[model samples]
Target: MRRSFAFKCTLLVIGWLLVAIAAVQIPARTFWPAAFVALTLPVALGLNLAAALYWLLRNWRVAALPALVAVLTWPHFQRGLAVHPLHLAGAAPKATAGQRVRVLSANVRIFNVYPQLREKDPASPDKMIRWVASNPADVICLQEFYNEPRPSRHDGRLFQSVDRIGEQTGRQVFLSRTLTNSIGAEFGMAIFSRFPIVRRGTITFDKLTQNHAMFADLRLPSGDTIRVFNFHLQSMSMDEKDIVDSYSSKAGLKAKGLGLLRRFKRGMVARSVQMDTLMRRFEKSPYPLLLCADLNDLPYSYSYDQLADHFQNAWATVGTGVGSTYNGALPFVRIDNQFVGPQWVVDDFRVHYEVPYSDHFPTTAEYRLK
Candidate 1:
């Protein structure tokens, strides 16, 4: 009798969880503001599936509840996982002549500038720079790109990463600084392109955060101009202890948990405002737009819903699987993305996971302007 009561109680709790998971899909954060809870939709969906299986094994009629919830939430799962019709061999569409332009977006975590990460691999900065140079995408959008003017023995003269990238890839470099000290040394977002930069500027967020977005108008070989918006939206900015490892004590854990929760709430509110501002700005853009960024928010939230609903997700149209770009301790999250307007066709899209130096992986998308 005790076991029967426990089983029924567990089933009831699972039913409520299933309802909560399905409800957040509507993106009404004002009504249901636990954005961080919505981030665990994938985990919730998986749990529902497991519960369905368990109930089926017990020959229980209540199995249908969890199964139905899982099916109804399948579209959210599909966005993160690729379900091919058949296990057939295939390749991305190849570019012919001047037909396609490849774009890459990455957040390099200030090129692993922290002493702890650098201590693990002394050659990380050099390796990362080489990797970026090797990719040679037509246009590159990098967040947390740093430039220190101090002379380095290896590179000599000045520690100009932007110039080095331009030298290696032969692209016009445009940078926008969110913060700068009395000295010229600074860190910010950057855009590098093979084509001429007709115009470039920054989109200032009124939020007090150091992060910002910028746009560059590049004139293509065919004389058509396209504006590329490189955004690094409001970050959760969780403490390093919350990220690198678990807290040791109960108090430390609780404090860290509360800190993260507070940051998540602040980030969500700031991001909502940022998204609204960007959409309004984009509405006036005269050229075709390609938006690339590390949107710290997940795809299930209001911010992502608004962006995905308006722009074309390069991955949804061409790439497969979760295409997860975040490679740090946090697993199975695709925070990096590329969204294009209707004036372009996504020939290919992929998350480059092989490069392990940064906390986030680089994402690339090949496009053909229509």
Candidate 2:
């Protein structure tokens, strides 16, 4: 009798977790705004589904509650694990009659030029240049990209990576530096395009650490002008040592966890403000807009919802499967995305997992004006 009572208590606890998980889809900034709590929703959904299966094996009636919650919250599951019939057709064709353009977005993470991974392979820089040259994206958006005026040759000549990619691909490159020195050396986001850039500008966020969004107006061969915004939002900014030390002891765990949570909260709040700043400018744009970004937030969060509310996500229309874009230790989350205006029809979208140069897998999409 006592064992059965304990089982009931455990089941009750699982059910409440499922409800909280489902409730996170609420479209608001402050209501249930904690990232730690929001991050558990995916895990809770998995546990709930497992419990539903277990209960069904014992008695069909006992499984209904968990099963129903999972079913009712099906949209969230669909977002993370979708399969489409269009995969057999492959990516959309490149521009032949000047109607379609292929765009690629990637956060290169400073070309992996840190001290710890110095010995791994210096070939990553060349690999990226060759990949972009061979793959041939018409427009490329890069974030967390680095540049140095007189970087040591040992640092892999990342100072000229932007110009190298442009020369290799025969595209025009424009950069927006979030960090700069007095000697005209800097690091920031960049946009490269085959089409002619008519104008360029940067949108600076007041409270962000080292991130900014920049826009370029390109004149296509068809004479259409479109504005492309490449943005890297605020990141959690947790170091590798922070993660390793967190698990070393109970005190360390508590301290590190709190520190990470504080960072997460700050990142989310800052991203919200930055997104609002972008949207206001986006509204005033004279041409059709395309947004390529490393949002550092999940699809269910307020940050994503607000940005996606008006724009159409390229992956949702053309991508198959979960389309996970992050290549970090936690593998399933997709924080990088490409969003287009309604005037474009997304013919194909894909996450390039083959490129293992950075913590993020590059995402590419082909679209034509509707």
Tell me the whole-model lDDT of each prediction, alpha carbons only.
0.75, 0.75
Candidate 1 residue spans exceeding 4 A from truth: 1-34, 43-74, 84-88, 91-98, 149-158, 207-209, 243-255
Per-candidate TM equals 0.80, 0.79
Regions of candidate 2 where Cα sits further than 4 Å from its true position = 1-37, 43-75, 88-98, 148-158, 182-184, 207-209, 244-252
lDDT tens digits by residue: candidate 2, 1-370: 8547745854765766655554444433354355455566666667778778877887677778778877886655555565456553654453344378889999988776565543566777668756765667889999987666565556545556666777656889898877776655667888999999899998888743458889999998888999999998878687757866788788888889888767767777777777778889989999988899998888756667666668878776666677888776664688999998888877778898889888789988888876
RMSD values for the candidates in order, in angstroms, are 4.3, 4.5
Locate the minimum summed-lDDT window of 10 residues in model 1: 84-93
Model 1 residue pairs with clashes: none
| Inter-residue clash pairs, candidate 2 | none
